[model samples]
Target: MPTSASVRPALNHLQQLDGIRFIAVGMVLFDHWMVGRIELPLGALGVTIFFVLSGFLITRILLSSKDKLSNQPNGGIGKYLKTFYIRRTLRIFPIYYLTLFILYLVNEPPVRRTIGWLALYATNLYMARHVSWMGTVDHLWSLAVEEQVYLFFPLLLFFVPRRWVPLTAGLMIIGSVALRYVLYQARMPWFIGYVTMPACLDSFGLGAIMAFWWLYERERFGNVFSRTRWLWISIALFIIVTTLTKVLPAIPDSRGWAGHHNIMSDVWERLAASFIGFFLIGRAVIGFKGPMKWILENPVSQYMGRISYGLYLFHNFVFNVFHTQPTHFTVRAWRRLSEMMPFLNSSYFFQFSFYLALTVALATISWFLIEKPVNNLKDRFSY
Candidate 1:
């Protein structure tokens, strides 16, 4: 068996990106379990971070591998696709399917009849129409969107001539924005277009465009984004705008898009978050050092980043299970302790502490027992 160092040598060294992963997944966890309790509006910005990061990293990898892929069997594209899918399958399918199988066996009520959607990566579609399924495997909607993006965007990048990649990415960005506008005006549920591939093309496209410019047209991109001021400005603007409106609020709450707000506000907010993500990627790729850099590269933060995938997958389920009033004997003991301590009773600090510790423990277990083992196979089909 390969050591952890051998399995992810390239990524393990990219400490900044790992830090960003923690930030992204951290937002999702906070928004789901802590936002209502704490009144912070993280919402979907975290998920958008993942989307943009995926676009940038995947495009960068594919472009980098073009030459090596061309030398492979059956004219490059076949081998490229086969290798890409295999690596993705190994990294993503094991934990994902295992989670679903357990959910099926445990028969989580909301999940009982809806395992098909989650298994098929259509959870977003199923939940958009049937709000009842919003709590079970519902967070998988983002995963569905990602899978759909990977399904087609990669083929476009692989087959298109190098010169036209930018144009293709641009059209996708425009198309996604237009789709969101149309849906908003038509009074469709925000959930409808929000989780679908077409409406999210802009986020992915922005990142892809940045990746193309950076890798293929590095001199030009570097010239424009060289100064650290631009990145700082982008970050400031993204935080201000995204927090103003809850684009994709917590599931089952269902109040984010119901009022008389201008729908275009939603589009602009998403675009803003995507732009911020693009600049952050630029900062990392350009090796800029600043406060954000220090925070991302911190030791504790990096450890959280390493297990972010498992944390994201398990957190919602864990939160739902424990964030309620005590029902069982062991849990009643925990509630009693909360009542005995003033700080714990009023602030619920102990409850939060306990839940966070348990979730991290579970994520650690999943990472070692499931994810790491499967991810070791990733490099076998490395791009």
Candidate 2:
């Protein structure tokens, strides 16, 4: 009953995924800026969401373009690889490198020393060894993971036969689990396994598997997605897994990275979070109409999604400044205003508003002046 088209259809901007991006970045913001101030296992969940999204989106793109990779005129594989890398570089490098350069000038020598690792997309490795923040660039570890994924995953997708891709993803997931266990047994610092690709690649690999399945086998994918029960099942699993593994445990010792360092606990948490991310994201892509869809596909959520990359990048700096110097201009102004109107300053409201305002302004400016402009050039190298 399925059409025999070999090439998968190109997809439009996925509103649900955009909404998911907003949620992912929002979690990161809460984690970095408001965890102790509020209380949630948000940072890890946010990072996992981002990793899963990257894997899903990248695999989908590759599968859709398989025709070009196979049959493009003159050196198709090289051309495809070049185009992929160039497009990715253009999308990622300008803002990322600029952020690093700014930190090198503004921050201390520790940040300067880590520039090598950051530049080479090895920040995760650097942080694994250092086990602490490198000025405000500590979050670069997630970006580094993505960069490394972009580097190798394309090669795997391009060369590996399509039927075997799922199996490869499964192996990768197993390898990451094995790596985590081995490292934990060897008495390596938790940060090493936690931050490195070997421990986290399962999230990415699982996402890739989902993308491959969806693209290659639309009939089965559709049959499952059309049933609301599957979505309910995924949501149930996500809730149960997260509550048992993350939420309840986090309440007693809510120090996040400092409090929860057990290897087995982390392994389960990451795996569960990834599966949750995959299903949530998968439902959105499949056009499941529900309250979840409505929330995720709203214009506001999509806008938040649009500026998410910049939001994720710039928010930490905003948090760092606000946290360290509460007397800074925005903070001062807000505190003074709150003195005049007591309600404004209640319960971290002033602090949250200050960071949100600055981060949004910076992200908007970056999107208009930098990211959007460079992004326009992406089509030039398209396969």
Candidate 3:
């Protein structure tokens, strides 16, 4: 492994990461829009990618802050934590609460019923306990997981000595797998095993490990991840594990593996997905070459990635099939538009296109009107 002295200078921003976000969000949109029409777990894949990315980014930021604060004569740990929480809140809370409030006002039943959990970022825990989905807001479970991570991960990173961070992350990865196995043995529902915070830690842990390697072991990180074969191997591993859950016979009375009744899903599929996510993220960090670079760095990809949070937040509401009544204003408007245009309802492609366009438009508006302005506030609280 190469030392930090031989590593590339740390980047202030990586446009390629936004491109990676674009890919992740795109997978989610495709999975949701197509729904039962497709058999793949694209949404889960996308969310796992997000978890890895979040883990990597958040860990890196906290580590950087810790390093900076250690050297400053007047540095205070309190300020380190305060600034992190404030900036994170500014970026995440406003749009989320606004959307939730609007949904509550519109009397969306699921939101009305689960607003407390949703508001507190406990939707995943609630779902695990209840063994049910919350209609269009089911997607929020991932967001909730991330918010919960933000709540505690910084403290963990801040206090742990930098050299120990990778070991700590490795333990988390192992603990996640163990927790999933325990859930499976306890005869818990697959959803419980899948959505709970402990079971999802592997994704975050793997990401943290990647970030640690990049920061402190850059030569090895660059050399290992730069090989395209590793990326392909991870992808292959993910596919094989996922496919096995489908092909293997289900255990008696199992809630279904990966939502299919197979006993093979939650125990290892998530870990496999995390590995792929780790590699994808690693490649993005180390940088892509030729066409890959062009694809990820393109203006359209960058813009979409920039607005991905809005896209993820608004998309389900915009094109939801889980709810009978429209949860979003755009959905309601589209229903009325379809009534007049009629042709909009004639083809699946047209419906998808219309809904996607609405999602993008709404997200664009949100970027300009809500998110960007709120994000500017982050500058005042910078680390």
Candidate 4:
């Protein structure tokens, strides 16, 4: 009944999933503002959303493809990895590296050959070693984390047995849990996970696990995501709890190393946030039910949903260049500043709103002209 040619349940459900993308991307934007005036906000939770979404989407893609054929098709993993890397490159590079060029004019020269590292998708590693040089668009790190996961996931699917999908997925979760404890034992600085592979997996793996769970057990998800009252309340509670962790200072024992003292609790909070992301994703995939559903699945926001990838990539660039100097208010000084304009200066809120409006415009252009063309071009290659 099954053949190697068919796509495993084509990702037609992505439209339903679009709502979550808007939320996750919005989280990143909101969280960055925290970096300016606030102590903590759950905005970084957006990264968690991105990771979970990554796991869900990628796993689904692989599963769908595998459903149609064997794991070793298209000249085995050599070809698999090659084409996979190319797709990732095409999806991320053009606009991302272009941002770097724009930065050269406003900021510093990050790479003489920015094209090389981006083409290779090793920009994350480059950023890791040269942290200062990298975050020209600071948000690119999350994209790097997602790319790193992509690098490993296919190889994992290829070698790991079909029945062991759950096993491998569990192993990743367990490994992340265990790794955090070890980092705690080692007296790491922050409780929050960063660009490291272990921390990143929670979000990505959560998404992947959701995908697998959905594909093989649709009725189960149908029942869970369908429940409007109890589950929505639960999603809210999970959000509140996770939000506290990022902002509220943990009551560390004043006696010894805070990292080691609260390692278990710290790890718990991180996992808890991941769980929140996982559940909300399920809720989003199931689509709207009551008022919350209407809010989540709004039409205008859905357009934002389609160009979300481009929006996420270019948003900080828009922010950085626009609000490069938000403190100064003098007319002569403001006139000299290229970042500000009369429309953007309408009010403080408008300044922030302008960044959003401009980002959507740039992202829309990049999406159609650059990202879309590159995506179409990727279709020409097959493993």
**RMSD score of candidate 4 (Å):** 4.9
lDDT by residue for model 2 (136-212), tens: 66777888888888878887887788889999999988998888788766756666777887789889898888887
> Could you tell me the TM-score of candidate 3?
0.92
Q: Best candidate per TM-score, number?
A: 3
Give the C-alpha miss distance for residue 324 in model 1, angstroms. 5.7
Best by lDDT: 3
* Better-scoring candidate (TM-score), 3 or 4: 3
| Model 3 CA deviation exceeding 4 Å by range | 1-11, 72-75, 252-258, 326-346
Off by over 4 Å in 2: 1-8, 72-75, 108-110, 231-235, 238-257, 321-343
Pairs clashing in candidate 2? none
What ranges in model 4 sit over 4 Å off?
Answer: 1-8, 34-40, 71-83, 105-136, 228-266, 320-347, 381-383
Per residue, candidate 4 scores C-alpha lDDT tens digits across 74-112 of 525566566667877887777777866665555443444
Q: What's the TM-score of every candidate structure?
A: 0.86, 0.88, 0.92, 0.79
lDDT string for model 3 (318-382, tens) is: 87775646446666777788999998888788778888898899899999999999999998986
Which 10 consecutive residues of model 2 have the lowest summed lDDT?
A: 247-256
What shift in Å separates residue 199 of candidate 2 from its native position after superposition?
A: 1.3
Query: In what order do the candidates fall by lDDT, top score first?
Result: 3, 2, 1, 4
